[model samples]
Target chain A: MGDISKKDRIITAALKLFSENGYHKTTVSQIANQAEVAKGTVYWYFDSKKELFQAIILTGIQRLASKIENRIKEEDDIIEKIKLIVMIYLEFFDKGRQYFRMFQEGMLAVIDDNFKNKLMDFRTKQAEFIAKIIEQGKKEEKIRLDVDSKDMAYLLLTMLTSFNSHLHYDNDFNIISKKDTIINIFLQGISR
Target chain B: MGDISKKDRIITAALKLFSENGYHKTTVSQIANQAEVAKGTVYWYFDSKKELFQAIILTGIQRLASKIENRIKEEDDIIEKIKLIVMIYLEFFDKGRQYFRMFQEGMLAVIDDNFKNKLMDFRTKQAEFIAKIIEQGKKEEKIRLDVDSKDMAYLLLTMLTSFNSHLHYDNDFNIISKKDTIINIFLQGISR
Candidate 1:
């Protein structure tokens, strides 16, 4: 805490508080207190709680995308890369369950247009990241050429989100088996 | 409105307001006004706004389940039944977009334990409905026997939800083609 800047400390404190208490319940004063700063200092960094939340979401998206990119940088097999991406997503969300809650809140709540657009941009960026991988697979002759990469990317991301929700809500879900199930179903249809 | 009972009128009014202005913004007075009922009448039928919202959600789940059951009653092919189930879900949510929004709200918001349990029940009921169809498919030797019906059912439902969100948010999505894509991807692997 001492080494890091006040802004980073504020973000760290806010993330913990937000995840624990939720968006509406959390207050800037609490965040400032948790970050060991004054309320005025907190406002100096962020205009409002909503803007602070937006920053967290947007930063989270970028961090996740880069983490996925970094993890799969060396994997040559496209199928394995896809599987890695799924696993990383599951693990990432499992750890940062707050982001998932915030995402649902952002999507469903009557938020302003600017925040909504940021969310949209997050989705598009994520899809594009996966779509690029699918395109690479096509180039490598590993993936079928008939399917639309962009559409497939979106569907895959959606499935991952669904699995994430299950992981959070359903206590009986076995993550290891479920990971295999997702990869298998994605690569091979369920049809006999 | 005249044909329905007072309870039904209140439910209808509540759903519309909840969907239009969201759950927190809507008030009992507004609901009574919309339903053309006295405020006491609304209170007589429902103890509180939260209870009214819960009733709406529970009724919606039952209605959707029965609708899917009726639509696929005559479809003999298990695979075709599954397809019809997907189509019906898309159509149902498309028409009653409010339900989808409410679902998101219910899942993410820090609501009461009973409401959360009801939501879990709604999800389980939906999955079980599809799992029954998959079981039938397995008995008919149409779907692979190795895959767990319940898990597959959950996955299929998740995919449908992903598509529903897309339908509501993404203006560029082509429903006709997207339906075929989901069916195709589910029925056949993306791999050639």
Candidate 2:
């Protein structure tokens, strides 16, 4: 029980430090101090600083994917699934804003080939997941038949991501309203 | 004439290097070498590497703003103006892909107070520009009167930026079709 809690604490500490100082500027000792764990204890869970960074990123993506997938599995209505997905997305990023910032930085950085491959796979999976939802909508006749599910999926993902990004840049933005507005805009064009 | 040409070359080289290696990894001497100018010449035109970076970003923004504004002025029809604006935006970024990549990096990086203020001002100007178009549409009764012009402007801007970003990540994306599709989706939406 203690081992599990110690590992979780180390991860939480590393995430905050990495976000504040960036991957290159942050160090293991700082993470240890922040976590209030012995330096050697970090090594027990992760091999090195690089591995820990990778773990933080990989874990974030995987956790988000699984959470969305599990919740979506319990839903049958296409529109409801989309609304739920958007809510989950906004909530996840809202809670882990720092982690998302780090993720964006990691994307631009020239990382190792293994990490690059993993990132690519994650993006593909995300797009595919959205596409599946659009496909389901089409089957239910909830979406326009002429619409390409893949294109619409991409567009929806873009809308959600961009709206979330704006929230980070502008603090005064009303989150709940923004989420609803995004969904409304997606469903109905700004037409009379 | 020679001095002006040298300055142009220096800016061009610096833009490419900075895009490839990021701001910190790049150096003034490397920029000079790439530009085929002496190190002193780079210092002559720009006080520091930081200034050069600001110049690259500011130039890109100003040029885009001017181009969109001028073309918008040429058209009285709101729909036509929107189409032309989208075309020009895609063309500008497609031509200067490297510069766009660098701009995104700069936004994420920690910068000086002056630069941050300028960035904020630039964003306001951009949103205002878009809002102006939407307001015109509303007056022309081409758009829904109930829609908040400011929110719609932000949404349109988000769609354009996100679509352009996806182009960078996915090389197989068809640019012209994507542009048309984004405009279509914005105007009509994907609902049946």
Candidate 3:
């Protein structure tokens, strides 16, 4: 019981199973065997499969949120802050490929309604953060004020969602690229 | 027997089965029974289930494409052309609610690889059509050529996908209702 780190062990096992069989088919016993932990041990850390799955999503979102918060905390300018978001979001999925897979597949037709609600709430926060950026840019005369920030934020989020296809199947279909194409497009789009 | 209409019989049965259960679950027997036709009669026109589904998608896509084509056909300016596309796309989805449901629940994930490829190709044509509008806009000095036409088309598509959530959910979900608000944001962005 005291021999191993439970949480890390659980996440590692869950990731493998989720990647292989998808979230729906994989069960606690399989994860327990892979983690080399007892069945009770897995349940102790995660009450159910849905909780474990939610944990994965929450961890990914929180990680992204914290990273974004830390990056923007250093900058006072709105434009610079927005730049960090574009780069960080792309990088986060790049680094956490499994999370990206889970994010896309689970986000589409996942079982948990509450988790989806949480996701929608997180999306609101992300949009709010973008709106604030647009507001600041407007105040500084770098952005147009006539247009609403909320809608624009939704636009950016959609672009980000499609951007996942780039990571998943870059050669077959891409949402962004190594040419810094998206970054340039955003800058050209907003440059006053 | 002669009074049984062909178009109404096939589609009415299809929409019922596809919506009630799903595309994959509903079989040809049920469809033929509902249509008051033999299985061979259903096969005579459709060839197979995949072909039938393709026929359904074709019906939707053609209807949308022709309407956009006709609306923009009279306009000389590219700005007017793009506006027509946006208007047509949103209006069609609004009015054609059943087709929209079929479209949103696209059989990309559940179908055979060959069938999925055909569907994806059809989608690519849509993106190409959008890119052509942007390309024409560039020639007309309406949009910048520096940004890739395909990418910009994708941008508009992405925005539409995100905004669709607002339509389905009762909550505004932070997206504004005003079309001009959205159009202005797309046209001018946050930048002054």
Candidate 4:
């Protein structure tokens, strides 16, 4: 807590309060108190609560993008790279379910047009990241050449997104342990 | 429209208005006007707008379940049955995007506990239906035996659900032509 910057502290506190009490009910004063900063300090970093909430979402998306980029760069085999992509998604959601919930709220809640546009932009960028991986897989001859990389990327992403919805209903279902099994099904069709 | 029952008329108008203007913005009188029925007549059928909204959701779910049940029975091949399930899902969403939006809104919006529990029940029943199909596929050697039927069902359902989200982002993406492509990717996966 001592090492964390005031900006980081505010953002962290905002995410917790927003997720727990929801966006409208959560106040900047509450965020300031949680972050151990003065009410005015929250404004020092963000102009408004809406801006702070948007920052929380953008930060999480950027963090995910960087993690996927770095992890996939560490792998060479196309199939292995794809598996890594799937595993990263599961791990991200499984570990950051709260942040994921925040993101969903940000998307669904009545946010400003600018915030809505940013959310949509993040979705497009995420799909593009996966599309790039599928493109690489196709070039390596590991994935089918017949399928459109973009569509396949969307499909893969859709599967992962659906996994989030599934987890919402069955929280007890262990996604972490099913990681390999999930990847296996994605990698090699479920057919014998 | 004339042949439709009063209850059906009320539900239909409510669904459209709710999907378009949102739940809170939509009023009972507006629904009554749209249905060409008296304001009191609307309440004669549904106790509240919430009840009417729940009825719309339940009707959609029941219709989908029955469609899947009847369609699967006509197909003997387990794989075909599963494919039929996928096609039916896409068709349902495509034809009923408004209703789907209502369902999503119902899910994201703050609703009564009864509505929330009903939504959860519909989701569980959906996964169970898909699981039954996967179990049959395994028995016929159409699908792999190593994977858990429930997990696989959830996975397939996840893929379709993702498709809906994808549609939200890229409305131009033609899911109909990509049906085989998507089903192919799901059944055989994207691997070469």
Interface DockQ of each model: 0.42, 0.39, 0.18, 0.37
* Residue pair clashes in candidate 1: none
Fnat of model 1, as a fraction: 0.34
Residues A1-192, model 3: lDDT tens digits: 676587789888998887555554577899998998998988899888768877887877888988887888898887777777888887776666556655444433443577768777887888898888887788898876656677667666655654553343222444435325565556545546
How well is each residue in B109-185 modelled by candidate 3, as lDDT tens digits? 23456656665665567678888878877776777666678877766654554344334322453233455544554
Chain A TM-score of model 4 comes to: 0.84
Model 2, B150: alpha-carbon shift in Å? 0.6
Residue A35, model 4: Cα distance from true site in angstroms: 5.4
- Displacement of residue A6 (Cα, Å) in model 4 is 6.1
lDDT of 4 by residue, A29-84 (tens): 89999999999998888887778887887788788889988988899887787788
lDDT of 2 at B68: 87
| Interface Cα RMSD in Å, per prediction | 3.4, 3.3, 5.3, 3.6
Binned by DockQ into CAPRI classes (incorrect, acceptable, medium, high), candidate 4 is acceptable
For model 1, residues B1-192, the per-residue Cα lDDT tens digits are: 448898888998999998776675678899999999999999899888878887887788788888888888889888788889878877777777767666555444436777767767877888898899888888887787777889888877766665555444454555555677677778774222
Which 10 residues in a row give candidate 3 chain B its minimum summed lDDT? B162-171
Output the lDDT of residue A169, model 1.
53
C-alpha-based local distance difference test score of model 2? 0.74
Candidate that beats the other on DockQ, 1 or 4, i.e. the better one: 1
| Regions more than 4 Å wrong, model 2 | A1-9, A27-29, A36-51, A166-168, A172-176, A189-192, B1-5, B174-176, B189-192
**Candidate order by decreasing DockQ:** 1, 2, 4, 3
